[model samples]
Target: MNCSRVNLKNNTLYKIALGLVVAVSISACTTEPTPPVETNELPCRVAGYFKSQDRVGGFYRCVWNASINRWIQYPYDCPRGLEFSEQLQACVKP
Candidate 1:
């Protein structure tokens, strides 16, 4: 009878330990997802900008330097009396 009681207690303890382990495992797997980082600024206007292509809007294609983390403009300068136009996607006399 004592042996049977011991076996029952051991079995109960083992089941409790297994239940705790399963609960912990499930909690570990249910973490909330991380939020995305926002990057609102334009890539071309940042310092250390690198031109990627020739004039698209009277401005060379450019990218913001990853280190600087700011908007950057293209390298080519617009001609006098003209300006680069985003809507026109080219340099304009206006």
Candidate 2:
């Protein structure tokens, strides 16, 4: 009988190589999203002071005032004593 032996296991080396590759791949995958660049400037000049009265937890309303030449924000509630005349188109809810 010939008494000879050969080691046929290389699990430790394989595991180390795999771990290094996984670590490198994970590090390469981390990146921050780029912010969008602003392309245009405001066209209209702010004529007067405008205030927004939107409620903390409710829908928002936008109003374009041709008189004051600026957009104003109003609360979700309907204006007092104003019978929401469908003709004026006063309030815009978004």
Candidate 3:
């Protein structure tokens, strides 16, 4: 009915809208971030580097053995204070 009353109502609506936007934004980001997928299968079939299922500082080198006619998973460990990185395909400082 009055100017002050109209301003009060408008202020209340603005606050409610801002709060709603903030709540939605917070809720949207509340979900947990997914972790990086790791491969943990059996004997390697391809000749390449693969992630080790046992340790973080370890990895498996899949090599083709002509005599055995199959691939071999040679377990290897990184140097002291290093970790295996999938992106780099080598051991790196964590």
Counting clashing residue pairs in each candidate, in order, gives 10, 0, 0
What TM-score do all the candidates reach, one by one? 0.35, 0.27, 0.50
Best by lDDT: 3
Runs off by more than 4 Å, candidate 2: 1-9, 33-94
lDDT of 1 by residue, 1-94 (tens): 6999999999999999999999999999996633323333234443342322344323444445468865444355567767677666666776
TM-score of 2: 0.27
**Local accuracy of candidate 3 as per-residue lDDT tens digits, 1-94:** 6999999999999999999999999998896533333345467778888767777687777778799786666677788888888789999999
Question: Model 3, stretches more than 4 Å misplaced?
Answer: 1-41
Q: By descending TM-score, how would the candidates be arranged?
A: 3, 1, 2
In model 1, what lDDT does residue 28 have? 91
Residue-by-residue lDDT tens digits, candidate 2, 1-94 = 3333222235666788999999999999998633322223232244322222233222223456789866554333345433332234443333
Full candidate order by lDDT, most accurate first: 3, 1, 2
lDDT for predicted candidate 3 compared with the true structure: 0.77
Against the unseen true structure, what C-alpha lDDT does each candidate score? Answer: 0.57, 0.43, 0.77
